[model samples]
Target: MKKELLVLVSLFLSFSSFTQSRESEVDRLNSIIQDETVHDTTVVNTYLELADQFYLKNPDTAIYICEKALSLAQEINFLKGQSEAHDWLGYLKKDKGHYDAAVFHFKRSLSIQKTLDDKLSISNTYTNFASVYTKKGKLDSSLFYHQKALFLRQSVGDLNLEANSLNNIGSTYHTKGNLPEALRYYIQSLKIAEKLGDKSSIATGKYNIGFMYNQQGDTAKALSYFLDAKEINEEIGNQSALASNLIHIGHIYSKSKNYSKAVKYTRQALCINNDIGNAYGRANTMYNLGFLYKDQGDLDSAYVYIKKSLGLLQQFGIKNGVAACFIGLGQIDYEKNNLVQAQNYGEKALTLAREISKPEKIRAASELLYQVYEKQGQGLKALEMHKLFVEMRDSLMDIESQKSIIEQNMEYEFEKKEALKQVEHEKEIAISNAEKKQQQLIMWGSVFGLILVTAFVIVLISRLKTTRKQKRLIQKKNKENELLLGEIHHRVKNNLQVISSLLSLQEKDITDEVAKKAIMEGKDRVNSIGLIHKLLYQDDQFSGIKMQEYTQKLIESLSNTFGFEKGEISTNIAMGDTWLDIDTAIPIGLIINELSVNSLKYAFDKERENELEIALTEKNKQLYLSFKDNGTGKKDDLFASDSFGYRLVQSLTRQLNGKLEIDDNDGLHYHLLFKSYKRIKS
Candidate 1:
């Protein structure tokens, strides 16, 4: 009986252990679910939980689990859950650098978010899309999408997200080498974060600002900002943030020629980053150390560090970083007088840099190539590479300068509008206070009747003076408008006459039927401009001429002169209440004339079904003029040569400083773009 009891107790203990193991398994599953699920606790959550469990070590199982969750979410029409699953899958694919798969899942998520009108989720999707584009070195598209996300975040009043978007925008600008603009946006983001008491965002912004300053050659300022950011991150126990700041500070010190301090900071950063398993951070620190050593004349150490960094970057498939490493190696070889090796490395780096759209890297590689060829006594090749380098550098600098100008203009306009609104608001408040005081005086008028009367007289006199001042300002503006109109009319008439005389002279010399036809076409164009000025002078309202009537008269006159009946050529003109100043109007008139003439000459070759459509619209401070004709399309090379007519059209178009696109798909479509000018009517 005692032996039997011992066996039963051992069996009971084994069964109890099995039950505990199953419970622990269940608990582990629940923990995974807890991390994966955002809000909904449904069967989809179980699938996501399973997916999370296998995602790291078992991608196939994770993918299957994700597919199951996706299917279940679709079955129940759970868009949010579906989007979440897709996002997770996309992130997983991105981790593997499967950009196509990642993009597909991200787009799926975006489609769901768009359908649901989930602004926050849509913003998140845009941010993700921007990340992909940035990785691809499509900076312009990335910036556009990031700005879209920023607008969405702002519209939704997502302050934290807005700050993130701002930071992302600064990063995009920084990549494009607009350091001052980047710093502006970064500082703005930092201020926003400080307002929200977001330590992480503040730290990130401060560090980025410091990095931008460092790139601008302000090492002292960069170090100050970096130290500030590092101190804050350290205080908050953010090891990753602190380490990033340290790396940036190291960069600044290296730029400042302080190799020892740079090495110290970089080593510290590398240790922290490695401890945290931040591969990207480790790679960056390594690169910094490589630069430090190179600057300190330690070529061997530089090569070691740079090669290590390149290996880490290759593991992550960072093409830009790899190109950078190649360029660094090329520079080292070039400095060591290894011309062949330098050229090889530089050419390889150049190829990769071009693929990755890294202009700075490309410029560096080009410079190296130029040097290598020059050293090899290949002067022509060196000169060619030098010229290319200069062209690329100038183009990049121009783009940066233009971008800066645009940003400055936008900011200035925004501030100006805000100031105007504030002034108007203050004026309203002052008027309200004055009215209240007047009412108070009226209430106590029995004792202060004379004083109130005197105040009223004084106020009346002041208002009259203000009215006179306003009238004078209005008169001055009207006078300026009139003068401008007169000048436009004068210039238009003078230009048209000059062209008419030139056409006449050309008509005398041309004997060929086609050549004579071209001269007459030129004469017709000259007449079109002359007609515009005639109409302008005929109208009492000098603000804008009536385009419909003006066009009708001009076309009718041209048809009569060309000996073509109005019914022979169909005219369809749809113009809005659009107006342009002389600068814009002359070019548009000439464009219209050219299109009309081209249509008349070539459109109705066989049958006389000459269908023409002309339309104009002003939107978004741009004027769009479109001319379409159902005619035999001209060859694409029609505008390639610099003929008299072509030159006239091209030069006029350029004078307007606008874009001109010609489409010959169906028949002929001519579109002209120019800035819209609004003239205040007197």
Candidate 2:
């Protein structure tokens, strides 16, 4: 037997005459839809309204009517009507177990509501989407949408909707078995509901908390909360909530083995459900009473109640409830030793449970069937049923395991955050202690001024001697480190020079001018990197290369290599003194070498009126390098043909994570921007 305390509370608020009022309202909307004189928008709205009212009662009819409304709204070009229709369609489709279709409609409504800039509609649609996703067993997606709805509702200052969003999120956590998170959200919702003085919402919050406590096996706490919710619901004349609370309290009594109290409360709940015409609630209570009677050894009474429940649930088209009723009947038959009849009932329950995708019911039914088959000496059949039962049980355990891992992660994050807050609090305490120590020092200094002066002089001399010794030691260590780094860089530069010399020797034996020129270019590239280490060896810092000085020296050396006179190819360097670490310096030097070599070879005329400009600067933590040549503009084959130098520049730019911009407005201009890697002392 099970109590059907809903995981998520009802969206609509309860009232004394809610059902009667809803019936009358539905009739009125239907009358409007029938009238030909009404505007298309009005007719569409009436249809949507009627469909919402019938959503729980007759979902298929609701879907049909909502479709009509949607069609008419589109014909009339009424965007608001269309959005409302889509949202209602989502609600109806979700109730009918069309989860994917329901999600589609919800998203469609959200898209339209966003275009209209209707905050309330957008928030409502988000909440509905979350509800559908939750029903589809997607807990993370459901929570995300609920959070979105909460943010939007809070921004619009709609405390009522915001509370509903919080409660819905709590339901998602509850389904995932994260009771602590569920309780937190529920309590937050309760606070908001109390602030807004929303009686129905307050009762919903209380009922959900009671249900959570019930699941936790705390009957005393659960019963107390259930009683509180019942009192409030009764005073407000909300029979639906009152009945739900009564039934749950009955469940608590049943768990504690108080059969008499359980029957009493459940029967009272049943009568109230009947009075309110709550077929679903009444059927659920009847099923619970059947199980109670069966446990008390009254098989005949159990059969009557279970049969009635099956009929009622069947009429309501609730397949899961029907499957549960069949399981109860099968158990009763098995108890009576009617093995054949028991097996038939068990198989029927299993089929319906599987059809409805109710794993718990399927497992229960399979277990009963397994017993019956074993009694009949059908070993293979019994084994098959046992396997099904075990498989379903294991599946449930796997789901629980996943949820436990998620809960552990959440707990770790929460503890980490709390630890950080505790550290901050400790820091404040430390500051307070420091202030007290300073006051104590001031008082002591006044009382022993003369003696303290003599002692202070002695301490000052000792401290001065110690500080000087430390300074001299640090200076000696720093000097040793600088000398070691300088020797390393000097050796590296010498090795590069040896390689360049070998390349020059190889160039002399080459007969082809093109091959010899290529060798010279390769030697030039090696020299550019060697120049950076040479500068590091010369400077005292040995931490970074000075770019301005390196650039001037590079231009002078390149001029001599290319046999370019002063007037023939003028090189102007305009930049402030900037220091870069070796990592950044090597790449910049190579890029400069390639561009300068390319310009000297192809970007000049016989008139000797060529100019090249190089500038470097740092701004906003970014380094900008600009290179321009007032010679011929870029030729068609300059970057189009994938030459080694052109590709190398592109590759090096990417390695630096920098941008390369080429503007051919005046001449060929290259602008590169990258993060400046400045040298920092260890």
Candidate 3:
């Protein structure tokens, strides 16, 4: 229903950047730094601690403070202090989008920590490295480092750090489009943070939960939690969060058609991002604004904002965002009737989306490209793009359907498969990086040829892999479903039987003969439908009703209901084994119920030997049915009545599109002919 490409808080996958007030800690660390006599490792550690205190609110100042610690530690040979400084600097740099530098510092921190044999320090460095990888869009690498930190933190019994790692891992999974896994990790992280009374972490969890809800199409619930989280973010001075919250809120408002409020909230978020120098946040917020403008039919505004967002995203090299912006630009151009520009933008978007291995974006780009191509008289290209679009759309649908089916039928059935997805994530970063580089070099030349080859090959491999991996899953599920389906049929039949019993119980109190007879007939009609279900679940072959046994049972049931003696009426059936699908069997059952009830109630008398006969057979590819009873024939027309049974017989005859004939000569007789019905497999 919704995606986090624009709405969700970036911190859902990021560490909680906000913390409780550190003024007192900052003051104490400053006091230790100013002590001229205390020039030991304590002094170096003091500088590192102070740098950590300032990092969030003042990143540049924090980096400046950490550099002094790094220098002093090198001079004094304080290895621990140097590692801590490097870790803090890496974190500070990562927050500011200085990814390459962040990695450099993080690697140095890990190197020193290896020598120091400090598990906590090493894990902390690992966490920083994970964040750097996350920002660089290397989700596989991000998850590996996050898992490493998580394990170490768990071993150290640091619930706080463990919560952070869990949240980071969830964030990585979220980026990979694995919401179930993401929610699993987020819940665990939230439980620990709530236990630790960490409001910052709580706020992070709140928004992530909201994002999950947003994806679920629960906009009101998502908005409620987002607003509550925003209040907490405000309380904790979470700067990035302020902007992130408004962007989410704005998107919701835009969905509600509250354009003015959406615009206000988004512009406010953009201003916040600009103030904080968060290029990523700014780029995304602008993208949201552009899309928002586009939705409102402010095409010019959409083009302007989207164009700007495209530039910033290009600068950051976020392929996902880049592809989305291209789609937006393409849409705007298509609206402007610039088919050529639209095609150009769609091609770029499709290439980048394919390069990034994002199916949703690929689908969007393919659709837009096909429309543009068709308009430009490129029928073959349009057809090809349309075919790809369908494959992507269908593949996504198949995966989603299978996932839902598996989840609903058997909880935890997919748990083991989750581990399979966790592998190759480390290579994900490397592969993505290499693809982006290669694509950039060859994009303007032979891009379509390259993309066509890459897309179809990848498409085939992915479908094959998905099918192979889930074949057993689906087969097992189908087996389970068959059992479940049988049980459902059994319960339905039982429920109908209960209703029939209730009618009989109610009929016992009725003193009127006519009303009692009507009640008897109503009960019998219910029984007719129930009998089909009864036959269905009683046997393994459930596709059709076995008419030979089923008709005998129906006659036996009616005879018992009417208190007729077993030998009082002689019955004959001409049909042998005829199996009709449930759809044809049901109405036929009801028709038989009405006709048999009428003969038992009105056509028969105790003075004469009763005789009944029913014939059903197929000839000339047509079904023929006959029923007759030896009794006094009524002078009145049988079907000329306002009774439900009379109308029901006529309606059912019309429903099957059959012709029916009745004769009142000597004894009542009915003949029916129908087009051949669907034959269920026996």
Instruction: Give the number of the best model, judged by lDDT.
Output: 2
Cα lDDT computed for each candidate against the true fold: 0.73, 0.77, 0.76
**Candidate 1's residue-wise lDDT over 527-601, tens digit each?**
776777766766745435666677777767866765787598788888756556544565677777766666665
- In model 3, pairs of residues that clash are 140-425
| lDDT tens digits by residue: candidate 3, 445-536 | 35444668776566556555655555555556556655665766676677667667756765676565765666666667778888887888
Decide which is better by TM-score, 1 or 2.
1
Off by over 4 Å in 2: 1-72, 93-111, 117-123, 126-163, 169-199, 311-319, 344-359, 380-682
Q: Give RMSD to native, each candidate.
A: 17.7, 23.9, 26.5
lDDT of 2 at 257: 83
Compute the lDDT for candidate 1. 0.73
Question: Where does candidate 3 stray beyond 4 Å?
Answer: 1-68, 92-101, 274-277, 394-397, 400-682
**Model 1 spans > 4 angstroms off:** 1-79, 178-188, 399-682
**TM-score of candidate 2 versus the correct structure, residues matched by position:** 0.50
Tens-digit per-residue lDDT, 1-682, candidate 2:
0011111112222322346677567556656666768888888877776666655545665687788888888888999999999998887777556778888998899889999999999988888888776655566888998999999999999999989999999988876656667877899899999999998899999889989878755678888888988988988999888988888988888887899999999999998987765667888889999988998899999999999999887775567688789889989999999898899889988988776455667889999999999999999999999999988765443433333433443354345335434544654565566556556655555556567887656655655565566556556655665566677667767876876785676566555576566667777877887788788788765657788899888887887788877667777897666877766787888898888888777776647578889998887888888999887766455768677788888888888888888877667889999864564342
By lDDT, the candidates rank as 2, 3, 1
Evaluated with TM-score, which candidate comes out highest? 1
